[model samples]
Target: MSRKVDLVADLGEGFGPWRMGDDAQLLDILTSANIACGFHAGDPQIMDETVRACVERGVGIGAHPSFPDLQGFGRRDMGLTADEVRTDVLYQFGALHAIAAFHGVPVTHIAPHGRLGNLVAVREDYADVVASAARRLDPELIVLAQDGKLADAARAAGLRVGIVGIADRAYEDDGTLVPRSEPGAVIHDGEEIRRRTVRMVVDGVIESRNGTLIPVACDTVLVHGDTTGAVVLAQQIRVGLEEAGVEIAPLTDWLE
Candidate 1:
């Protein structure tokens, strides 16, 4: 059987007048996008344009909900209860849903952003609430997450979970991503990232910081668009995957 995976990036991450990355260029290389909702880094106009562009390109649209932390770009850990998390996520998800509906496109999935994304991997209560909110909103919605609390909670709630393998990030031997605050948490070398991506998608494994082989079952690979040379890195990854005989497709098209 041929190996198939989705290439996704965080989009619509600009608020008001500031833009973060070249979403226009990155969109050409992506099969899906996790667009930010208002709470983190998006505004009404950005969301609308992002969705319109995604619709035009036939890319899968997924909500990227974050904590109510715009100042921190959703990277700050606010001490909120699980209920707060649920409501915040609901607000963001609903906003995106309305916009997508206006464009005649249904949102195919949901992925938490930044700190919320990290917590969902280890914090079980937060993960459960996120999963429950997604279930309550749309049972058919696929939950994109790395293998952790969110994946487990989503699965238990009968939601389809698409494992996200990030090739540009470092992982521990235990199969969890290293915290971003730590040194060397993110890989910068272009050739290294390309190799890691192909290995994660085709070989089903990635090398850990400790030189251990951590097995990963990836349905989608995240390509960060905000960093330096990000578009170039994304282009290289796609070429590397195609060269390795991996079939790239949208997550909604293949994830079940």
Candidate 2:
């Protein structure tokens, strides 16, 4: 039997004059792209360009929605009601959908960003709202999330779910990601990342920060595009996965 996985990266995370990562290089290396919608780090022009690039490359396009925090890049948590969160997500999705529509590309998935994403992994209400928003927008849209509340809510809401594995972030024993403030939370060693990525895809397991072996359902591996040496890291992961005999495919192909 052959093992298959999707390689994904966050793209279009740039504002008016400032850009975050080498989106062009990362796009070429990824099988799927979680494009930033307006709230977190993208504008109309950036979204349009990103969609066109994805169309040209035949890459899977996904909506990356986040809290309404541009200064903090949506990494700061806010106290908002369920309705507020739902509408915020809907707004972001609508913007991305419009841009993708203009470029004649189909948005196939939805993935939360930063603090909103972290909250969805643990908070049932947050997860429900995000899942509900995606369901309302498009029932067929796949929800890319970790193995937690968001994934469960998405599945329960009759939406397809893809379990995501963050290759550059450390995990807790309960499968949650370690807080970024903590030391060693984000893995930076290329060799270590490559080895761990291969193991996660091949064995469906990853060692937590506390040295606990946790079983994970990894449908896709995410490489942060904003990190230093992100393009090189993505290349290393792709090559390592292929070398380990794992077929790299898009999330849409693997989603149920």
Candidate 3:
């Protein structure tokens, strides 16, 4: 059977006058959007606009919560206790939920952004707390994380799981996310990204940065919205994947 892939665009630009991503254009190319909440980068206006845009484009909406570090764009790692992580995650996620609700758009899933996302992928205690926050908010909200124990934990807790796979990064043998600072971490070549993603979907496998083939359960594929040429990349990916006979749907369809 041809594998189905959900393309998630990380929408919601920067706060105030400084815009970070081409959210409006990117939305058209993706199946779903991981909308940023206030903690990481987006502002009230940005969130509202993002939600509205998603609704207009018929995109599946999901909360993209992050650590409270807009200055660092939520990519910088700040060591925090597990409880602290949970609290921050829920706080940010809730903001987006309300914003989406206000626009009459039901949030379909929850995807952690930047540092917070990396933390939850491999940290057992931190993952537990973060997953707990999602479950507490709504058991039906799928938690988008690297497809593995994290997804399993969320499922075990009765929260729907969206196994989001990435082509640029890799998971170490210990399950910790490979830091982006490492060499060859980010896949800049568009062809490579497409090839990796195709392999992941068709074979349920991806080559780690360490050159090891690892099994990955991918329901959604994340394309970073902030990167330059991200919109073009998403378009290319969508066209290429569809041409290969892969169905592009939202998180809800895959989870259901």
TM-scores of the candidates are: 0.98, 0.98, 0.93
The 0-to-1 C-alpha lDDT of every candidate, in the order given, reads 0.94, 0.92, 0.81
* Local accuracy of candidate 2 as per-residue lDDT tens digits, 1-256: 5788999999999999899999999988999999999898999999998999999888999999999999999998988888899999999999999998888878999999999999999899999999988888899999999988999999999999989999999999999999998999999999999999999999999999989999988999999999999999999999999999999999777667
Candidate 2, residue 32: Cα displacement in angstroms equals: 0.6
Evaluated against the true structure, the overall lDDT of model 3 is 0.81
Q: Which residue pairs clash in candidate 3?
A: none
- Stretches of model 2 off by over 4 angstroms after superposition: none
- Which whole-number lDDT from 0 to 100 does residue 234 have in model 1? 93
User: Please, what are the lDDT tens digits per residue for candidate 3 over residues 1-256?
Assistant: 6667789978885889888878888888888998888887888999999999989999999888888888888888788888888888878778888888898878888888888787677678878887788888888888888855567779889887878887556667544567888876677888888887878777888787777887877888888887778888888777778877889887677666
Models sorted by lDDT, best on top: 1, 2, 3
Which residue pairs show collisions in model 1? none
- Model 3 scores worst on lDDT over the 10 consecutive residues at 167-176
Worst 10 residues of 1 by lDDT: 247-256
Candidate 1 ranges with C-alpha deviation above 4 Å: none
Candidate 2 worst ten-residue window by lDDT: 247-256
